[model samples]
Target chain A: EAGVAQSPRYKIIEKRQSVAFWCNPISGHATLYWYQQILGQGPKLLIQFQNNGVVDDSQLPKDRFSAERLKGVDSTLKIQPAKLEDSAVYLCASSPGTSGEQFFGPGTRLTVL
Target chain B: DQQVKQNSPSLSVQEGRISILNCDYTNSMFDYFLWYKKYPAEGPTFLISISSIKDKNEDGRFTVFLNKSAKHLSLHIVPSQPGDSAVYFCASRYPGTYKYIFGTGTRLKVLA
Candidate 1:
């Protein structure tokens, strides 16, 4: 079985530049999630999508960040005018159900100078 | 406030020895706990889990123990191997919600 897939495994951008990360989850998985992992910290939930509809995004910094899962299959996370603090690994995960073991991707490392 | 914490930043164990990793949480409302292992440049993978109502859940060489009263949990790996070396994270899910709180993670190194 194929695992979650992510593109541009590494990204570098200067501060105030916009950046985006892409994620393609495992087949047949209905629940997708995006997380941010800063150095020395655990992955923080940014948003969750249950078949293209957001289930939770309370922790997301809406003023600068946005994400969408179109057609409930693929997802994208974007950050506009990225700040130095935005430099972190962006991880995408998916699960077969709303509540179950989640499979993760290699993650896209974003470096905002 | 940080709900989940793994006070131990790192651990080292000899091959074929037992390795124990601990986790603690401040919130008493968490109902499910999970353990995930992560390799360098890779995302976390589920290792094992236990519910709030259960004290122990074992799977092969991995075992998870939950102590609700103390708000503590642990993961034990028997006869540790070099391949088992990785960062381990503990996460808890809020009751009535799918929200999960994760710890900073503990890096385990099993020396061969």
Candidate 2:
């Protein structure tokens, strides 16, 4: 079976610029998630989508970050006016359903200078 | 506040030996705990997990133990292999919530 897929394994952007990351989850998966991993830290939940509907996004920075999963199969995460602190790896994962084991992608490393 | 923490930054073990990784959490509401393994430039992969209702869960060479009273958990890998060397993260999820909180990973090196 195919695992979660992410594009642009690496990205470099300047402060104040905008950047976006894409994710394609495994087929038949019903839950998708986005996470941020800063250096020396564990991954933090940024947002979750359950079949194109948001399940949780309490930790997301609404002022600068946004994400959407229109068809429930693919998702995108965007950050505008990126700051130096935004430089981190963006990981995407998917599960068969809520409370199931998650499979992750390679992640997109974003470097904001 | 950081609810979950992996105090040890790194651990080294010889191949074919037992390897144990520990994790602690402050929140009492967390009902599920999981362990994930990660390599450089790759996202975390699910390793093992245990529910609050159970004290232990074992799968092949991997086992997870949970101590509700102590608010602690651990992962044990028996007869560790060099391929098992990687960063391990502990994550917890509260009941009725989809959000999960993860701890700063612990790097484990199994020397051959």
Q: How does each model score on lDDT?
A: 0.94, 0.94
Residue range B5-105, candidate 1, lDDT tens digits: 99999999999999999999999999999999999999999999898889999999999999988999999999799999999999999887666888999
Could you give candidate 2's per-residue lDDT for residues B1-112 as a string of tens digits? Answer: 9999999999999999999999999999999999999998888999988999999999999999999999999999998999999999999997776578999999999999
Question: Model 2 chain B: which ten-residue window has the lowest total lDDT?
Answer: B92-101
Model 2 alpha-carbon miss at residue A22, Å: 0.5
Q: How accurate locally is residue B69 in candidate 1, as Cα lDDT from 0 to 100?
A: 89
DockQ of each: 0.79, 0.82
Off-target runs (Cα >4 Å) in candidate 2 are: none
Per-model interface RMSD values are 1.0, 1.0
- C-alpha lDDT of residue A50 in model 2: 93
Error of 2 at B40 (Å): 1.1
